[model samples]
Target chain A: MNPRLSLNQATIKHADLATALSLTAEAGITSIGLWREPVAEVGLGRAATMVSDSGLRVSSLCRGGFFTASDPAERARALDQNRRAIDEIATLAEAGAPGSAPVLVLVAGGLPAGDRDLASARARAAEAVGDLAADAAGAGVVLAVEPMHPIYAADRGVVSTLREALDLVCDLPAKVAGVVVDTFHVWWDPTLPAQISRAGAEGRIASYQVGDWITPFPGDALLSRGLMGDGHVDFASITRLVLDAGYTGDVEVEIFNQELWDADPAQVVARVVKAFDETVAGQL
Target chain B: MNPRLSLNQATIKHADLATALSLTAEAGITSIGLWREPVAEVGLGRAATMVSDSGLRVSSLCRGGFFTASDPAERARALDQNRRAIDEIATLAEAGAPGSAPVLVLVAGGLPAGDRDLASARARAAEAVGDLAADAAGAGVVLAVEPMHPIYAADRGVVSTLREALDLVCDLPAKVAGVVVDTFHVWWDPTLPAQISRAGAEGRIASYQVGDWITPFPGDALLSRGLMGDGHVDFASITRLVLDAGYTGDVEVEIFNQELWDADPAQVVARVVKAFDETVAGQL
Candidate 1:
């Protein structure tokens, strides 16, 4: 197994923190990217201790951003939630082995319900990142904005491209905010290579996620991510671009397929290891 | 009803060419964008006659371009088919009432089965458009490249943004090639305003299509488009940009919702008119 391969917990959606860590270690992978829900279930302090016990690097914390709300109270609650997430990321990263990235992956939420003003929603999302900049910087945590595919533009994310995500954090220092280059979301961008290069040059590439875009999307658009080699994404080429762009971080395998989530966790980890080696691990 | 309003035949998918024309005329829509499949169902000449008899203008032809095939035989067939479609567009435009536009909307097909070379596939799609440029120009028709949303990037269109589509025809005259600004596909783009401005400035805005991007995409992503004012698209703002950028062509309402398709055609047309009037037509 590749040392830089990180098993993002979402790949084994039902696995508890202890189980996820055990699976990664047993599979010989050295890194793990965790989600807030599972972490919260275990309690943040216990989750941090679990990470220390596993002796694996925490590539990133799954998420912390849905800042498109127009209601002041909702907006304030979102900000407060993000600040807590930033603190969680700081604790988790500290508990992990050296080289762990203190990165909080931020997914800009979709438009506010019944709101058709996309520009204003996008502006609010950017402003929210700005609002969180100080908290992130103060905590030595990086807010990595993950721009989702345009398909989720209405309900999941308004930041639909790496360019837009990077634009939102341009004013902040790289240590305060950056971007995640998730293949599932950005594989179709014509400006991908240029933007990846720009991200590397600007030192804003805080995380590198690898996932395949499968065809015949499932009934739920959110579960459309597939195993690496089973879909149409050319991992070798995209991995090459990422390496060329100087992103030498852990290549996190983050798939969100219903079938995979239902499969045996150990078997899924084994398959992910093989797929990563065959498709993207070699480039890293 | 807005004189510039055009009913794209796909909005009434089950309607044959005759019924589609009658519906458009009865609904007070001054024009109709056609689909070749329905036109082929009645033979081109007779379909043209029906369109002419209806006394409505032809805004553009629905499609012609699946040119991402890797096989030489497939590529030739795609180009030949596009050429025929170009001739059909010319004939239909000539038969329609005055102000008819000889335009063929081209959907750049997805990657060939099992192939993941997006850059190569995109290049081929663009080259195919170049191959058809002469035919389109000769027929005095414009081949309008319709950039579908990135959600369709793998299986429907490799050209996923207005910027990429415009770049493909940058060297050609607007008369030979242009772009279709379908709001459903591009409403999520942060760069939409700038791209529309660029399209108008370059005289490449061949068609301005209106559709809505609704949430919880139905099981089939293809049928995800909702009617105008029924989803998150801010049509009034987009229409203002198009008008401000100087695109005076038909504002064609093209939707693909299952419910809308199953609804009474007259009622659907009425709803479209009301939606367009409330959401987009006023800006025109």
Candidate 2:
């Protein structure tokens, strides 16, 4: 089978939900990764139907977890929002018809206020995931925990390494937990190969996202992602490792850059597709 | 004995070499850490004599390594520069009355040609250090490998963990190889406690530096370090671990902030002294 390629909506931020959907369809890409805010803006039910009619597969939902908050009320709010997101994902999967269940990706939140205690933060994140897993399982949505880079340790995700993510998931049964290995986050890790093998062996490989790293221009951590072949990451080796890890899943191109967003949406998709092809060819 | 505190010259960057010396002496900090460019600006021999006459101990020279270049000519240049740094360190030690040797801190350079091949870069660094170790021993100066943060793995030092630093140093004899544990680079590491014990057991603990983690800033990779208590690092716990590891040396404050650099040099020194006192009292 030809390699499955999915376009994460962030890569085409220049387009609205309708525009992104239409552009993606025109580009002949069969799968997409959707973000929550855009879906909500278009109304989840309407958005689900739009995607359904488009005949595109939903590879994974953008995210669902900000489990690290100091206030109990805030934590409860995050869980409630996540449960609602899971329900929406279940609806979308059903609307998309049989044999099309998109993975629900979880981005475990960073440290709580006045809390530099990483150990406790990690414990809290794992506990939150355990609570969310039951609902996710019932909905037939595979929960994929994406371990973000260490730079995001303070404000994004506490699960910075695949080993750490696997350890967290080990508490739950294999069917309940899996991990998403994003090249942008795990490329710099020294323990990538071993962790990838472990994830695959345990049946915990759920999603595999790709993006390159670009040093942010100071105070812009959230959006400085690089285009493929634009940075120093070894995508060829990483893709080989993921494929070896038994990850026969969609290769999602997820970039968050203002430069790409400002360009034409079709141009961005075409460029990424070309890069993805080159990456597979070992020319990257 | 009261814990002796030292000021790394980078913390008071605005002050000229002579001014920093006078202010540091007046602040009751009898130990100092000097960087190469500043030493070069004010002739190395003259700077050494000035430091000696001020009746202050030179705790460690700031650096002497950038061994990640792949080109033969560039590699030779790096080694030659390191030799000169070693010679200057020897001159400083000799110029000071007998029995006052300073440790030369080494930051093994990052990837060569901007390439991200960590294992190869590490091998190159180890080979270069083996050559420099003999010169360091001959000059009565100990070479201290300072493992930078993992965030710097792509562009700075590949030796991001204390365990990795110790392993790199193991290539040399015990007398010639040692490691510097800086709080800023290592406090977040999960294996820090165990690594500290290992370093102590192997008699490789060379210098102990302190700084905090300021958010949302890159701070010039080598510079832009935070002041203690102003960031997230647990200074007291790390210091205790270092002490437990048989490190009975001066705790040096090394901040590299634009705000602090613009302040009065005397004010910066005073603030550091206060922070050091508070950190020790709070941590102990």
Candidate 3:
């Protein structure tokens, strides 16, 4: 019943699937989030079995929705690709055995290439989410629609708020559609506490990812993410809010800073775990 | 009538007040936005007289509200400082002479140092805004609460949306409190069109600033702005929206790119004016 700690693969981008798995297991973590590229590299079947046998859970899958392409042919290709992603999550969840409902984190793709129509892009993404409902439900995977920061709205995902993400799938059951609570993305949201409470009330809180907002953000701003206490995000309060929203789920510490990535994987893991313990889990 | 082109001073950061004034006037621009620093550098009286004699309208006074300090003494100091900003804007309004209702754009400052409570910061800002109601009304200056991009919510300004800004000043008369619609800051908002319409309907459209959203943003991020057509912002539509909302005011071009700053002041003015003509005003 101790707070579940899940390591997001991107946090250790250099680590291969084998090394990542072994490291997470060695760290005494029961859950490890999987990224599509790494899982595919290891072969989904092999990856699933490795995770299964290792007794570590696949807490979530790092994406399967980019339904914003404006071209008809490209849109069809995107849907087909998403179907395959859903199937992979389903298979991984099945292999992980009892109680493994691996959430498929869907990063609503940004505006279609060279297109400036955000409304249309968002509409297309919403429609695509509905189209995948049957496939996702059939696979017993929840579509965890994630809202990236507005900084990414132009060329990244159109879904950029918890309310917007939830509204996209309000009709679907919690197992079919939910929202990912990534503190790094949603921490600046003024209405987040209310939205988190609403998300909990609606039973659509899919996954919780945590990273702090550091200052003097990197030139490549995505890598500006910091370990919990290393930046401005009030983890204890947000975690409390998430917990209050009935999210007794895996607390994924997903830092993507260059210094962290450059550090020895073991050292990075130890440092991150210690930070999480002090900043998030220990405080709770 | 000619879509009143006004150059924001930050768009030509390297230029002295006199150079910026002459270049803008020579470019046939009828109005110019002023930042407090450059105006102060030239002596406010001389600067005001120069702007008045040059026959150029003062479009807006670039900022006057940072009422989010956590300390009681700091909060009182901030209020007093903003009163001076209001007084300065009033003097500029007076000096701008015929056909000028110069707006005082208020950037609600970000959270206080070492403060993690955004809700309190926002509340404090809201309160500070109300405190300025009397002074602003007396000065004949509109306190335009400009909502910054959410990325700045942590340390720059807590007002991150037009709706939030409007809510803070909705009860105040349009002449007392208004909102600045900088396309760069609010273009990503899904409810922008509606919000723009609302701002116009409420007569709270204080100012309209234009800048495009170029990618591979600069290290500072603020200077990543580009000319109208150089980025993904759909200025024609946004301009149309603002026009529809009854904003018959100067359309301020406010690019903050380092390259733009390094360019010859006159040349940058010409290029921006050309870009605006083609991408925004021409299309509109």
Which one is best on DockQ? 1
Question: Which pairs of residues have clashing backbones in candidate 3?
Answer: A110-A156
Off by over 4 Å in 1: none
TM-score of chain B of 3: 0.97
Q: Give the least accurate 10-residue stretch of model 3 chain B, judged by summed lDDT.
A: B93-102
Once model 2 is optimally superposed onto the true structure by TM-score, how far is the C-alpha of residue A276 displaced, in angstroms? 2.0
Residues B138-230 of candidate 1: C-alpha lDDT, one tens digit per residue: 899999999999989999999999999999999888889999999999988999999999999999999999999887788998999998878
lDDT by residue for model 3 over A1-284, one digit each (tens)?
Answer: 23388888889989988888888888887777888898899899899888888787778888788889989998899899888999888888777636566688898887765678888888999999999999988888898999888888877678888888988889888879999999989888877999999999999999999998877566786787888877778888899999899987788878888998998898888877888888788545
Docking quality tier of model 1: high
Record all residue pairs in model 2 with backbone atoms less than 3 Å apart, i.e. clashing: B110-B156
Q: How far off is residue B91 in model 2, in Å?
A: 3.7
Give fnat (model 2). 0.21
- Local error of candidate 2 at residue A240 (angstroms): 1.1
lDDT of each: 0.93, 0.80, 0.85
Tens digits of per-residue lDDT for model 3, B54-94:
88888899878888998999999999988988988889878
Q: Which segments of candidate 2 are over 4 A away from where they belong?
A: A94-101, A215-219, A280-284, B93-101, B218-224
Candidate 1 vs candidate 3: the TM-score winner is 1
First chain TM-score for all predictions: 0.99, 0.94, 0.96
Q: Could you give the candidate ranking by DockQ, starting with the highest?
A: 1, 3, 2
